[model samples]
Target: MIDYQSGYILRPVNQVFIYFSLFCALMLNLLPIDNYSWVPDWLIICIVFWNIHQHRHVSVILAFGLGLLMDVHNSELLGLHGFSYSLVAYLAISWHRRILPLGLLTQALHLLPLFLMVSLFPVLTHWILSGEMYWSALSAALQALIEALLWPLATVILLAPQRRPIHVDHNRPI
Candidate 1:
């Protein structure tokens, strides 16, 4: 392939794997830990990654539903996560082609803003509505920075199953 991601050809990603990964990420996010601003939203990050790599399987509706589930689980305002997640999905899906061809760290840098938006949008909206604004800017930045820094690692792990070669036929042409 003229523009392959790596030396080995990635296998066709199964729908089941995509959903299972997303589910695992969701479960991780749902753990009852004290809400920390520095903690990255794994669900949103996974959703964004899947949106970029497997948009056909992972769509905005899925993101919206996942966000709503998170909102309910966290006992926060309704539709806040839903709206932000869907927005991120739309942005990812629309720009995925451009993003896919870039280097890993550059991809992280490009996506940093999207992560920041997801981190801050709900908090900012809630603050504005309830009129209790605080220093969320720093927290959102921290969360986004952490997530962005992990993007390359996330990609490596997530893509491993697809990248592993089933058979190496030296005689066969790629």
Candidate 2:
């Protein structure tokens, strides 16, 4: 087995895992959660997590593409989710270094405003276009709360593989 000077081995994250996780998140977003249609935004959560932790792997272009897919899936305005997700990607990338050292709860707190903005922008745009405020502040708050609560779990599950060191066989002939 390969030994590490730091006493911990870390496996390189594969591109396939990243894409697969994103796909899973998209599928989760499409799932119908009974009467609670306002389930926390799974796609956004996954995007935000990757943006902060694996910024190099997830880019603005990818975010835009995923957003467009989400828009098509949800039958909403074509660019709405795309714009929101790209904005989140930008914000997360900008603040990633600063947010990385903080505890999970702290990171979630830092992300609350971004989550709120994500939930609000479309509502505001729709309101302006339709001249009716169909948005509910309480619903937005609940969604943000749920997202924050799920952040830790997302990190643990999504990042767990990356945290474990790969076992290399030193005895194998190259």
Q: What is the TM-score of each candidate against the true structure?
A: 0.91, 0.84
TM-score of 2: 0.84
Tell me, by TM-score, which candidate is best.
1
Residue-level lDDT for 71 in candidate 1? 91
Residue ranges of candidate 2 with Cα displaced over 4 Å? 1-9, 34-38, 135-138, 165-174
Error of 2 at 101 (Å): 0.4
| Clash pairs (backbone) in predicted model 2 | 9-165
Instruction: Please report how far candidate 1 places residue 70 from its true position, in Å.
Output: 0.6
Best by lDDT: 1
lDDT (Cα, tens digit) per residue for candidate 1, span 1-174: 112456666778988999999999999998888788777899988999999988989999999999999999988799999999999999999999999889899999999999999888977887889898787455777888999999998998888777756677788775
What's the alpha carbon RMSD for model 2?
Answer: 4.3
Q: How many backbone clashes does candidate 1 have?
A: 0
- Per-residue lDDT tens digits for candidate 2, residues 1-174, read 111223444467777999899999999888866425258988899999889878899998899999999888777799998999999999999999888777778888999988887777777878878898864543776777789888878877887776643565678553
